[model samples]
Target: MIRIVIVDDHPVVRDGLRGMFDGDDRFTVLGEAGDGREALAVTEAVTPDVILMDLRMPVLDGVSTIRELRSRGSSARVLVLTTYDTDSDVLPAIKAGATGYLLKDTPREDLFRAVLAAHRGESVLSPAVAGRLMGQLRSPAKEPLSHREIEVLTLIARGCTNRETAGRLFISEATVKTHLLHAYAKLGVRDRASAVATAIEQGLIRRD
Candidate 1:
């Protein structure tokens, strides 16, 4: 039997998943957690073969938890099971070391198959998620800058210092710097001037 740990913020969802797996002869429900932090603890203690993870939760989110798990050298394969299928949700989780991404609405049999595939160290993706990844591959555009990163670039183009940008955006100066750093990395520019210029050239922000 494959050992499994379910991670979801909702108790009902956790119970439902546990019941589903427990009813299956090929799988065993080893543990459950309400959020990512608790997931770390529970999975550490139980050492499950596969982890069913949710994307959104209090304390810590799924992607961060997956990264933490990988950093700690845990051998458990993570399989994301969440309601969200958007690019923002799917891309990060996959990049953070999820073995599979399945929508919550996946058929029971399909879910079981996905878990089996995950245990075998195979990649699994819901149809919608697979399409999104395909679209990303076909697109020639660079990684899109987030809205907040665009806001930071817009402020910088308007001659705002990091401190001034923080004041205008109602965020901390450190946060302003962090956004700038992210923007720089995404835009492939090393400094503020180049970031602003690239954002303008790409039409991500207004030159005026």
Candidate 2:
């Protein structure tokens, strides 16, 4: 049996996933967590073969959790099951070490197959997510923004000035400007406004 852990902030979602997996003879629901922090604890205790992770949560988010899991040398395969399919969500999760990315709207049978594939260490991606990744990969001119670049752009999108962003990120103002310049070049934008717009358009940042 493939031991599994369900991690999501919603109780209904968690319960539903548990119910679905519990009836399957090939899988077992080892435990559940409401947030990424709890997920770390539960995963460590249970040592599950696979983890179904949700992106947004009250405490630590899914991408950060995945990175932490990898840094800690946990071999459990992470399969992201979230409502978000945007580049901001999908790319970071995959980069952080998710074995698969699937939208919450995915069919039950498909999700089951995805989990099985993930347990075998195969990469799994929903059709829509796969398409998005392909588009990104095909666009040679559109390079991915670095983590710091995204942070700077996110702050700028929120109307923060370079100095303010630097203070918030605890970096020097010059460093903030450097990140902005890098982001602008990667996004093929000439200025902050255009860069922010392009990043949002490309789903690199959430639009508020």
Candidate 3:
């Protein structure tokens, strides 16, 4: 079973998640924490297989907690479950070593899938969160993505919001996030600025 630990300031959120994962043959909710410092303490004590982290919390907050986890070389992958999927939220979590990111509103099934994927060593993002990440796969020489990811990239280059991109591309924001996460892995880039700069250098988008 996938051993999981949850870290969120809200007790209800933690309880709900625990109930969600309880007794699943594929996963086990080992423990949980209500703040950053506690998260560290519990994580060190139990060495959970994965952490379901909330970005906004009192005390250490999710970003700093993730940094500490990395600094200590904890192999536990973090899956950031937050209410905000904005650029501000998405960028820092990845920068701080979170393996996956999604809004708290994520459907329970997708949340479970994301956790499982992260445990398997895959980076996952909500589509609204992935557009900026996908922008970096701009390469002239490399084989371009099929029609969909390209649409996501173009909208990213144009600074369109994920909602706008979704509207334009006839897809959901989550779909956009998945595309960008795929692109991020392929391009070896993280976050918007690096992704965009790399794309420009690769001639995937016009410098003008």
Which prediction has the highest TM-score against the true structure?
Answer: 2
In candidate 1, position 58 carries an lDDT of 96
Clash numbers, per candidate: 0, 0, 4
In angstroms, the error of model 2 at 12 is 0.5
**lDDT of candidate 1 over 55-137, digit per residue (tens):** 89999999999999999999999999999876667888988999999999999999999999999999999999999889878
Q: Candidate 2 at 132: error in angstroms?
A: 0.5
RMSD of each: 8.4, 5.4, 13.2
Per-residue accuracy of model 3 over 66-137 as CA lDDT, tens digit each: 999999989999999998765556777899999999888889899889999999999999887787567544
Q: Candidate 2's residue-wise lDDT over 1-208, tens digit each?
A: 9999999999999999999999999999999999999999999999999999999998899999999999999999999999988778898999999999999999999999999999999999999999989987897866679988998999999999999999999999999999988888888889999999889967778898
Instruction: Tell me the TM-score of model 3.
Output: 0.64
lDDT, candidate 2, residue 102? Answer: 97
lDDT of 2: 0.94
Ranking by TM-score: 2, 1, 3
TM-score of candidate 1 on Cα atoms, chains taken together: 0.72
Off by over 4 Å in 1: 143-149, 152-208
* Per-residue error (Å), model 2, residue 192: 10
